[model samples]
Target: MKKKPTITAQTKQNLIDAFWELYCAKRIEKITIKEITTRAGYNRSTFYEYFTDVYDVLEQMENTLISKLKELPMQQLSSPGDPFPFEALVSMYSHHSKYLVVLLGDHGDPAFQGKVKASMKPMIKEILVSQGAKDGFELDYTLEYALSAMIGILSYWFNQEKGPSIENLMELITELSSEGVMRKLIG
Candidate 1:
């Protein structure tokens, strides 16, 4: 008999959560399907139905995150005089901190960081232009720096045992974005 969509989705999430728990503790190569199935309380056959292997689970999770990131209200930032949506951005990131902290960590996939930067490029460019940034090498370098800094800060925040409040995090991002790091540090 066909299963309810909710059940199917929950089952998949359970497997993913189980895999994620193992993934957080050790390298992906060392995590076995048996471990995931056992943690998820599912048979091996159930895992195969949702994912081909451990790597597939990671791929799906990354795709889901990237898709959600793309869905953020980026277009709103294109309008002139509109403040950067720091609150929205932080809210989204905080919501997914569990996955992001790991995916962007030392033990995580290095290439995933690039995927995230790529997804945010267009919005970043729009924000730059709106802020009077000229289009050229400077823009390119600034974009690269901003993306790197964002990822680094996010990784740092999420990895902390007792990180700053979301409001404080948002304020920090705003300050860094508006005032150059050197200026913020010097003053």
Candidate 2:
């Protein structure tokens, strides 16, 4: 679908950027749309044009993140495989670690996390199918199961003060899944 040129996109993006800046200097609960628009140099209507509230903006941010991560060709990924993309993703996350920490902090919505999980199901199924797991192999059930597992691991990595390096984590996931159940369908 071709996106028509409009102020909505710009306003939404500006709001998101504003939220990021404010989120750094203040807590998410303390922030307001007034502050977001002011920081973003937009007006109230512009802010309304984008998101309903601070949490709404946060939802948009999470969706953006999931989409970004989803862009990665993550199916069939294994140890001793490509390093560049995984490294790039980790680097990006590390760069924005503060943003993520604040947005997904203790008070964040479980439903927001659920949205991310729901969103990634199709992508996970794609990876599974490409790796020789049938496209319809228990479909939604397996997709959700695998995606939930991946999300759980990623959340642990994201929350920790120190954890396995991305390279290590990538290899870890591959080893855990690839050789055990994942190899069964292919062989």
lDDT of 2 by residue, 1-187 (tens): 7556676677677788889888767667899888988889988887886678888887778877777766665553432222123444455556666655555456555565577666656665555555566655565555566555655666678998789878899788767656643454333
Error of 2 at 91 (Å): 6.1
lDDT of 1 by residue, 51-164 (tens): 999999999999999999888887674334333455666678889988888899998999899998888877766765766656677666666776789789878988888999
- Cα deviation in Å at residue 27, candidate 2? 7.0
Against the reference, the lDDT scores of all candidates come to: 0.81, 0.65
Clashes of 1: 0
RMSD of 2: 5.5
Q: What is the TM-score of each candidate against the true structure?
A: 0.83, 0.63
